[model samples]
Target chain A: GESVGLHLPTLSVQEGDNSIINCAYSNSASDYFIWYKQESGKGPQFIIDIRSNMDKRQGQRVTVLLNKTVKHLSLQIAATQPGDSAVYFCAENGLKGGADGLTFGKGTHLIIQP
Target chain B: DAGITQSPRYKITETGRQVTLMCHQTWSHSYMFWYRQDLGHGLRLIYYSAAADITDKGEVPDGYVVSRSKTENFPLTLESATRSQTSVYFCASSSGGNNEQFFGPGTRLTVL
Candidate 1:
């Protein structure tokens, strides 16, 4: 059984500060990872993604770092804003032959202290 | 627009009753998934379909059933709802293996 887990269940940060969310996966065969953001009442939106071959990938103001050796993945948000506050989830896609579905981690609630 | 949508944004049903949640995608993605989000459990996959008429159970598929009659539609039905089954349900679709999945606005199910 493959499992994706997060280090923290909740994260509180002040506006204008940087936010970092960490995730650890148990499946070493996972080659693809994605970071998703979900608002209070909305669906999960794709933030960024990285392949096992690459260690890092950047989006508008977000960066995803993957440490395959340690089976760790992290999402970094620069200049965090109030709108960036949401539950962030990390998912792993390691199913061989496309039989396995994405495994999501317990999300980290990002609360912004304005 | 290319996106995924879930019907009946909110649902309230009684225990032992059957309830169905509808999921539709416009991208014609090959992969569709159903997940339930709980307070501490996060998002657990209930079922997924690789293509039309092909489906499989996921981590928590005990009380759920899914059918993929069409590529754009994947619906999940709870044959006998229970109090423990009350949770937010989400439907998502992806283009291919290990690709980014687009999610729909979740349907909040309350089993009374």
Candidate 2:
């Protein structure tokens, strides 16, 4: 599998630690945002999403926080495990007309150290 | 075994040759998409289909063609393969507007 993490920012965390991956998106008009995870040689997988009207959303072991004022979004993973290691991406559906599709970020590689 | 799937997980071809990448989804999602992932650029949409017999171009549609004659199959064709087109291609599907998209494993196409 080809690695999409080349030349990308990396966040290394210790096992059982909390890891936060941050993203700054463009497009003040964008209303929907999502987080995706992609392992080496694999396609992006949907992890969670947030609508513009909401400020925060939570999942099993993940939490997505959105700040419209700063156009910032963050994914907080609790008790990170080795299986959580992968490249994470933040996407927004705030394109000019919303006709195109989601605009994805470059991605962040999460390296979990035992 | 019932999900979005892509064919020819790996392909290698020459320049100026015609190549077609197949995408099929059993979920019967109304929306389908084709994207190419590069190093610096994450994933850029190449083309998409809203439904059967309906298709549209995306950010980078040049040198590519797509057709969705059936509700479950959307195939992307490269009229003339070029070295610059070498990238991992991904196909995705969504139930409807703004819904989460399910992706296939992807096809690694290499143009020589």
Candidate 3:
């Protein structure tokens, strides 16, 4: 009965501006969360991940923020570029002593304007 | 040089026909998953195999079946394809539970 959902379906940002995508989850038991980027024809690619113990994690040009109290997660991209345009997905992992499987969200389409 | 791969990148079949989508992983991961992506519905898990001969149904397992005869292969079959079955199928594998999954190029199926 756990689900991950995005706050927005589409986002548009200027080429040089920053972008923030938000996600909300309903499973408090989920301790692991991952962000994936999927291009038009390719499969989802791992972007960054964060565990419950930590509130934030940073990658090359992206940062993931987690708020356990509010059951919310977000991905931030600095200096957005045209190549960063893609569909972003948030997935949750709550094995709970069982085989770990991911529950994916509906995805947010990011459009970077050049 | 080893990763996940899916066969029949594109497929078109008539209703009531039987079709199978093949998935192979060279990582020899213990966990493999099958998912279908549709507009507005996102990616929904169909089935997953934790190991050889151990398979379990996922959120949208109806009208679909899966088998894991080996640790590196997990195939999904549609016994009787229907119009609603038209969607992009993706195969993913992870080294273990809760690990990052590596996905294959997906198979697009269109059932008429």
Q: Interface RMSD, all models, one decimal each?
A: 1.5, 1.6, 1.7
TM-score of each: 0.96, 0.94, 0.97
Fnat of candidate 1: 0.75
Over 4 Å off in model 3, which ranges? Answer: A94-100
Residue-pair clashes per candidate = 0, 0, 0
- What digit string (tens of lDDT, one per residue) describes model 1 on residues A2-87? 68999999999999999999999989888889999999899999999999899999999999999998999999999999999999
Q: Find the 10 residues in a row with the least total lDDT in model 3 chain A.
A: A93-102
Q: Write down the worst ten-residue block by lDDT for model 1 chain B.
A: B93-102
Candidate 2 residues B31-92, lDDT tens each?
Answer: 99999999989888898888999998888999999999999999999999999999999999
**Worst-scoring 10-residue span by lDDT in model 2 chain A:** A1-10
In the predicted model 2, the residue pairs found to clash are none
Worst 10 residues of 3 chain B by lDDT: B94-103
How would the docking of model 2 be graded? medium
What TM-score is obtained for chain B in each of the predicted models?
Answer: 0.98, 0.98, 0.98
Candidate 3, residues A3-110, lDDT tens digits: the string is 899999999999989999999999988888999999999999999999889999999999999999999999999999999999999999854522547888999999
* Per-residue lDDT of B11 in model 1: 97
